[model samples]
Target: MPGEAPYLAVADVLRARILAGEWGVGERLPSRARLAEEYGVGRNVVQRAVDRLIIDGHLEGRAGSGTYVRSPRERLRLVRSRHRERPAGFPLRPGTRERGRADAWDAHSQVRVSAPAEIAGRLDISPGDLCVTTHYEFLAAGQPVQLSASWEPMALTDGTPIVLPEQGPLAGKGVVERMRSIGVVVETVVEVPRPARATHAQANLLGIGAGDLVLLIERTIYDTRGRPVETADMVIPDRHREVVYEFGVDLP
Candidate 1:
């Protein structure tokens, strides 16, 4: 459209004012009446303009206080290399590459759990088949940053020393390394990433607002024979983190 609405036009100037540092982050905007007079618009128009900026994430409203420029969120990067999660000590393997190396992690595994149909399909097992399910919460700088729930068929690791994901000698060692201990060679990892809104439970766990954006990662680990040995769903708060992918380029 050649001409924006009256309120939208006012919003544009107000946005420009904010971006130009007229009102810094966490600084309150002038009263609606004040802005209305300065912009030669009605108070309702000024209020609507401010509301639009709030919806666009440029501003936030506080109880009994005027709207203020939102503080720019500090986001950390969570990287996924084309080839990652290989067990340590593998010949020709690169440097230490695993999850949560930069943070602390807590994991709990429940044994003899029956797999649901959806999980069974991913693991290529019958519905209600026995498996071990593990829940993980990762903290970066002492704050919750990531969450995941992993599943592994008990038929493959029932009596092994590493059967429990977070307990035993190989406790907390990752799917690849534990499977390797039992002679199952892990060769591939596949991840599907999607955008999702934070659920109430997820919002509480990650300490974020409900409906906040998040990255949902559905990941599966496979063996050399193309059998899926483990599957996990990873969650990261989009407002607090960004996902980065890295690939190696080889010379011909």
Candidate 2:
């Protein structure tokens, strides 16, 4: 196309060649200077194209060596099951075991944080209301697989042992168990999953291209009385995982 960016045009050609197997997996690509001369563009243009390909998972860079084609990675299965246990020690909904073995996760919580408008809407609370906010990173085999930001109304757990989700005796216990300890019986969970493009920050954390596809899930947990208890937004990189939804069938 006329007026197209020179780097993008170079990237398109390089991508096509890689897809056509001009460069086999693990095969090193020609030097950036050579590519620049061939494409009649500056070395910077070739460098930009190679950088994009690296971010897109089509290539890998080596220190003191040239870039090489990357091998395809197997995507892990991340299951979201309605029947999974959400007790004190079990994972909530998308259990870590679904991805294979025991996955590791770390969470940081801030007390009395003001809820943003979107989070407030999901929790059915007013904007700027006090809330306990938690940011989580889930890892599989020491690689990041998922990220989540969760919010809980402070009014519900004020002065309670479960006020700080990752603190107190119930530390690391799931939302259901923690709420139960405070006399709040969790009844139902609602999740809305959608496709999204990774932002630069998300891409950096997930080790994927900035515009790569990711699964965005908006989840909210409700109490027995239908009061919203906790809400969260989860981000799963499409390059690394496939999400599956499972529900048990009841017989009449």
User: Relative to the true structure, how large is the alpha-carbon lDDT of every model?
Assistant: 0.85, 0.88
183-246, model 1: which lDDT tens digit per residue? 9999989999999988999889898766677899999999999999999999998877777776
Worst 10 residues of 1 by lDDT: 92-101
Model 2 bad stretches (over 4 Å)? 1-16, 31-55, 61-67, 86-97
What does the lDDT come to for candidate 1?
Answer: 0.85
Candidate 2 on 1-252: residue-level lDDT in tens?
A: 224687888888999999999999999999999998898888998998898888678898899999999998887778888875556876544454564432888889999999899989999999999999999988888888899999999999989999988899999889999999988999999999999989999888878778888999999999999999999999999888888887767999
TM per candidate = 0.75, 0.79
**Global CA lDDT of candidate 2, please?**
0.88
How many residue pairs clash in all the candidates, one count each? 0, 0
* lDDT accuracy of residue 178 in candidate 1: 92
Which candidate has the top score in TM-score? 2
